[model samples]
Target chain A: MFEYIVSKYNYWVYIFLMMLGLYGMIGKKNLVKKLIGMNIFQVAIILFYISIGSKVGASIPILTAEDLHGSANPLHYMNPLPHVLMLTAIVVGIATTGVALGIIIMVYNRYKTLAEDEILEIRKKSGV
Target chain B: MKVFALLTVIITGVMLVYGAEDFPKWGDPNQPGSVHVAPRYTQGTYIEAGTPNIVTSVVADYRGYDTMGETTVIFTAGMACILMLRKKKRGEGESNV
Candidate 1:
């Protein structure tokens, strides 16, 4: 059981990071902390993808004359799809972080408080 | 809370016992996902994409639309923040602040 779990450790890591990030994102009151938590959540997905794309014995895919000749021993080739996906995911994560931070700044400016409770009270008083 | 935890533990244990039967054999070649669907991409994604990588293809082509939408969600959030936080100028006073 231990060995089996070890072999699939990436999944475990992904789940752990995801849970941690989610907890922080949902449980944290400070806007900045929530943003950081969101980033953590996104990063977990990236890790999941990268791990999925990996093969134990794979080589990086780049064609060369030797590769064409077929003389090179074809042992293992690293999967590329997940890495590609990770790139997009990383970009999206950054965009989300930027937008989330922007919202935090806006919240700060309007309510002069980062606490969600404080903002909610202000909204109530303002009838907004 | 204690009852909830006990319930959860019992349910999880039951699932674990039954799930083993349904779970796909680890690294079974017959798995649909493991099959090499395309020749160029089949052997491995890195060789096919001319990049040193498989995840790339899945992200770039397999599910590119999903990623695009994820980015758009951020854009929408940013716009919402701007609109919500917009304040009237000092001369305009707090009428619309």
Candidate 2:
């Protein structure tokens, strides 16, 4: 029982974080808060991927002299693919957040408010 | 509406948690992720790219095209933000009155 829990505990933590972020994204009224939630969700996913790529006794993915002299064993080196992929994902997330914030600013300027409900009401009144 | 959103999120989370049970343990070396083409990338990175960092090798060597596309996406997004958010100056188009 203990072994099972210990083995999968990381997943449980990520799940909780994912849920919290999901709730914030869906239930929050403010656009900035929703953007924050999206950031949290992306971060949780990145952490989960990174954790999966880690090994118990592996070092960094950089190849050292010892690796060249001996057998090129994968067991000693952590997986590098996930890290590379997540690096791109993080950059994409930052770009997305910046665009999203800009759009939000435009929305606020046009509607004179930031709340979703208020924006909707204004749109309805204006037949937009 | 908030309650409905909460319910949906809870259900999605439960489903995701249940599905995660089938994933390989934290660091099983022989898992499919490590077994497939990843081994080639890890093994050949040094010879193929001469880069000490395997991540850098894979990103810049093996997946160069994808990285280029991603860079383009970032540029496009920046341009979009500027186009949408930049306001016109006060006297730019006012007929000089």
Worst 10 residues of 1 chain A by lDDT: A68-77
Best by DockQ: 2
Interface DockQ per candidate: 0.21, 0.52
True contacts kept of 2: 0.66
Q: Residue B52 in candidate 1 has what lDDT?
A: 33
State every prediction's TM-score relative to the real structure.
0.65, 0.92
Candidate 1 regions exceeding 4 Å error are A68-75, A125-128, B1-34, B42-97
The residue-by-residue lDDT of candidate 2 on B4-40, one tens digit each, is 9899898989898889878888887776666667667
**Between which residue pairs do clashes occur in model 2?**
none
What docking tier does model 1 reach?
A: incorrect
* Tens-digit lDDT string for candidate 1 (A5-116): 7666666656667666766666667788778878887888787666655555556644344454333333345544555556766776676666667667766766789987
Candidate 2: regions farther than 4 A off:
B89-97
lDDT of each: 0.59, 0.85
| lDDT string, candidate 2, A27-124, tens digits | 99999999999999998999889887887788899888756532568888888888988999999999999999998888887777889999899879
Share of native interface contacts recovered by each model: 0.15, 0.66
User: What's model 2's interface RMSD, roughly to a tenth of an angstrom?
Assistant: 3.6
Tens-digit per-residue lDDT, B1-97, candidate 1: 3355445545544554454444333433333333454224534444434443334555565566987787787678678767656665668645432
